[model samples]
Target: MREFLIFSRTARTGGKINPKNLFQEGRLDIIRDFIVEAFFTANKKRSAIVHCFLYGQPNPPLHLTITSSAPVSIDRVKTATLLSDLISKKKKIRGCEMKKESIIEFLTKASKTKTIYLLDKKGKSIHETKILPNAIFCFADHLGFPRKEFKRISTISAETISLGKQTYFAYQALMLLQYFLDEKGID
Candidate 1:
């Protein structure tokens, strides 16, 4: 299955989410948008999973795993609501599962089984690279990952790939990546 791990530098760890103030509250709106893009199409959901690594106030290193296989409807509002319930309850809520896990830890473990690709503008073009099955694309939120985290990730053996020179939002990158994968019949 296609997997995406998004690192949100300013997304809240765990707490009540104000749907109207999602942008102000650690840019949860971006996370919601990413989830919507990852799982939803015009008429149905895609077979994919999203891992959100939230490092913001109240708590740090909150991991929210959203799977399309779960029996729940997904949309921008529903995604935010699910995040709110998962954060407050700190447990599995329908399609979402919440936990406290660091990005490094998750990558280190995933690298053993899945092909990890780091999405960066400066990296090699995605067209040149061979994307294997069960590929896990790693990317950052609007604020982007810190330099120190890059150093930590560099040691994990993940190949960096670029969509193009033009910068795109995380959700846009995900959509483009999915399209490319679909065209190539990777998934």
Candidate 2:
């Protein structure tokens, strides 16, 4: 199964943030489209795991993992509600809270079997990169990864990938990646 790990630097972890205002808040704005498209792009089952680092919080970041083929809601507003319930309460809302983990912890745990790829223009062309059967894709928010976060990710030896020379928006990049994967019969 294809898994997408998105890192939102400004997304709020309060679970109270309005989904409709996700774009206005400059937090989940760019990722909203990606989350919506990632699941629907493929006929096969796919998964999207968003790791949100709130603007200054002592607690852990919010991790939302949703299966594309599952019978759960995936709309923006419904997704917002699910996120709110997932982060605010311990109980699962319509099977939302299956896992709550940190990025570091998740990276270490998933590193064994899954090949992690970081999206960056300076990396190799995705068309030529040999993709593994079990792969996890990572992307930073529009604001981009800060120096510290980038350094940490670098230590993981995550291969950098680029769609082309031009820089595209987060959602556009996702679509391009999916399209490339589909062309390679990887989706």
Candidate 3:
């Protein structure tokens, strides 16, 4: 299955989220949008999974794993509600699982099986790279990955790839990447 790992430097690790104030509460709105993009298409859902690593105040390194296998329908509101419940209750809900894993730990295990690609502006063009069917695209929030962490990520053998010269939001990048894969019939 297609997988995505989003590193959010400012997303909250716990506590209830103010749906209306997602931007103030560590930009949870972006995380919500990412989940929506990962599963929804025009009228159907895609077969994919998205892992969100939140490193924000009060707590750090909160991992949210959202899979397309969720029984309930997903949207911006539902996604935000699910997140709030997951954070406040600290329990697994349907297709979404919560954990306290770091990015390094997650990548170390994922790299062993799935082809890992780090999305960066300075990397090689994605068009030239051979993306595997079980590829996992790794990216960061608007602030980007931490310098020390980025260095560590490179050492994990993740192939760096560039969507283009221009920068795109994490959700936008996922959409483009999904389209490209669909065109190539990768999954």
List where candidate 1 sits over 4 angstroms from the true fold.
71-74
Could you tell me every candidate's TM-score relative to the true structure? 0.94, 0.81, 0.94
Q: lDDT tens string, model 1, 1-187?
A: 7899899988877667776668987998888888888887778788889999999988998888889865445656766776776767745666678778999999999899988898989988999998888778988998888998976876674688999999999999998998999899987
How high a TM-score does candidate 1 get? 0.94
Candidate order, lDDT descending: 3, 1, 2
- Clashing residue pairs, candidate 1? none
Cα error, residue 115 of model 1, in Å, equals 0.8
Write candidate 3's Cα lDDT for 44-129 as tens digits. 88888889999997688888888887643565777787777777774668887888899999999988988888999998899999
Q: Give the residue spans of candidate 2 off by over 4 A.
A: 24-26, 42-58, 69-74, 98-100
Clashing pairs in 2: none
The global C-alpha lDDT for each of the candidates, from Candidate 1 onward, is 0.84, 0.65, 0.84
